[model samples]
Target: MLSRLRDRPWTTALLIACVAQLLFLWGLGRPGKLSFDEVHYVPAARTLLALAYPANTEHPLVAKAFIAAGIALFGDTPWGWRIFGTLAGTATVLGVFACLQLLFRRTPVSAFGAGLAMLNQTLLIEARTAMLEVYLGAFTTLAIAALLWSMRGRPALRLTLSAVLFGLAVGVKWAAIPYVAGAGLLLIWGKSDQRDYWPGLSLFPALALFGLVSVGTYLATFAPAFFYAQDPLTLSRLIPFQVEMYQRQTQILAPHPYQSSWWSWPLLIRPIWYFYEPDNGVQRGVLLLGNPAIMWGGLVAVAACLWAGWRRRSRALLGVGLLWVGSLAVWAVIPKSLGFYYYYHLSSIWLCLALAAAFHAYAKGRFARANEWFALPVLMLFVYFYPIISAAPLSGPQAFNRWMWLDSWR
Candidate 1:
């Protein structure tokens, strides 16, 4: 056992972390009742499975539809509806792995960065839940990864595939808007001066392909409408259904107890507890919090990315940095109410990217390696706070004490 533990490398760390995530998730399986938002989504999923979304369902059907598919197979257990999310989360980690390999191109630093992201608590939590954030995060990461691959060599079907993934990300959640836009704008900029780039008809064809996929998926979501309709064209009723979805999202600012502004998220000032039960003796509960080490360290890493961008103007690094910043800028400007910490899941990917860039720079000797030891302290912090973050075991006062940096976490 001792030798086996000693033989483990970074990948093993990620695997262990993922195993812990799975166990925690399994512990949450069929915990008797739904948590806050799952009440809305799980029921919507069940409704979709039953072919009974209201004519005016509020959000896009893609995610709920995904949930419905799982419920069909797994029969509405916690793991049932959540199984798709877990798959997406695993795909997200693999996407991050592919993206880092594309970004750094066969380097140990690239592998390390991917490992860091895999072990990340934020990614693990979202992956284990029946939430749309995991889907959004997976598709968005794949889109970015495909973009990176396209940039490194001659464009082909892979480039087209990247665009398709970009569209899927948006289809999953309109929150993907900024990241998709950033990728599209980068593609345009990359192809601008090259006369042979064929920016016109070639790109349009790929986009059309994406549109066809989107339309077919959207229509299939309303398949129930065809069951009892007197006419074959009854599927057209989905148009008004879509309009209602858009209207609900535009006006949804309902009051929520855990609402926190976007500004508060970066500092770990607010965290949404996805599931909690003080009566459960803490052995079998889940508490959600951003990894403070990764999050706070990200702020410093971003500043460093800015400095590196100004000095080197590496288009690759700049593209990565801009991708991160532009995505966050959207959250900064949106008028949506109760933008909780989970919303940061998309933005947090970029934060990890920023930290990757910082680590890459250190590995390349752009700065002294003396401060590399700083990671030890950060790792220690993650370890020290794991109990409270996971709600493992603690007195009320102990839990309260860990809420040290709260601004809006009440």
Candidate 2:
């Protein structure tokens, strides 16, 4: 069984990603009203679909463009707009799985990472919505996977292609900036410092290639207005639109009904209920929360990542640190005007990576052999608590009854 599993075909990885995505899309089920940030982006996407580029937005039209694509395909239903996000999410799983294959050179770990992602409801929930973050994340993962694959002497064509994907990621969401920076650092390490590293001829060209692509793509969003505008008011609308978008990002959010700090996120201390109602005589809603087992277990794993980075400076540990530091940096320094739990999507990817690294370290069996067994119980506990977190259909106070260990989860 082990041998057969290890030797599973590469197609199986793609299949796993596809199946997971299909399941999530199916669960999305209906075209409900705009929930959460949908209110902001959906209208903008409608504007974009009509070819009137809205101004003052911090992000490029890539995500809205994607939403537009769904509209074009299926005609402006909620499911139609969100299908793109679901597809992006699947692509992300494949990218991460491929990256694991490249980094660790083991099919099992690659399979494991993708498999775990398939089962992770948090990632699924986010992916099944018309959100830009998942789109950004997918492109970022793909770019990273391409970069890592290039390290193995794959193809120069891939190197240039990866740059375009990185540009797309930045165009989708600015959160991916840190991961892009990390890729540049990896090149520096491979070229100048590492002992066994072979400095490839394409490395410098690749960096310059990606740099130009990212900058040029970002600037291109403005070109339509600059070149094709019919009147001065067209220009006027563009500038303020861009400024408000930028200001909204940096503005410190005031305390609101459901605001949460960054510190409370990882603990799953307070989950935001995305939809809640008793109008139909029952509570039907969706709770935006993290996987408790993964979230809490990741705390220990992240600490291990820090220790490993400090002591041996292992490539894996260093990768984890870069991911963690970069993902959390904006939240740490930026003044908060509007804050919510979903912002953790960027940082949460690191939690997945950190846990994977910890499991990889222990998989060598040098540490306590019993740790592997512990994963079973942890997995069970995560499954047990999922219904409440999802708010599937729990009656009256039973819905809030999972307040057993984590009182703050209430």
Q: Candidate 2 lDDT, tens digit per residue, 47-122? A: 7666564443656678887887888898777777788888888887887688777777667667666765554556
Tell me the TM-score of each prediction against the true structure: 0.81, 0.85
Clashing pairs in 2: 55-241, 55-242, 56-241, 56-242, 252-336, 252-337, 253-336, 253-337, 253-338
Clashes of 1: 0
In candidate 1, which residue ranges exceed 4 Å CA deviation?
1-32, 152-156, 193-240, 278-285, 364-378, 388-407
What lDDT does candidate 2 reach at residue 191? 65
In model 1, the worst 10-residue window by lDDT is 224-233
For all the candidates, what are their Cα RMSDs to the real structure? 4.8, 3.6
Q: What does candidate 1's lDDT look like per residue over 353-397, in tens digits?
A: 777776676445556542346456655766665554444555653
C-alpha lDDT values of all predictions: 0.64, 0.68
Top-lDDT structure, candidate number: 2
**After superposition, candidate 2 runs with Cα above 4 Å error:** 53-56, 195-198, 202-206, 221-245, 278-282, 309-313, 365-382, 385-410
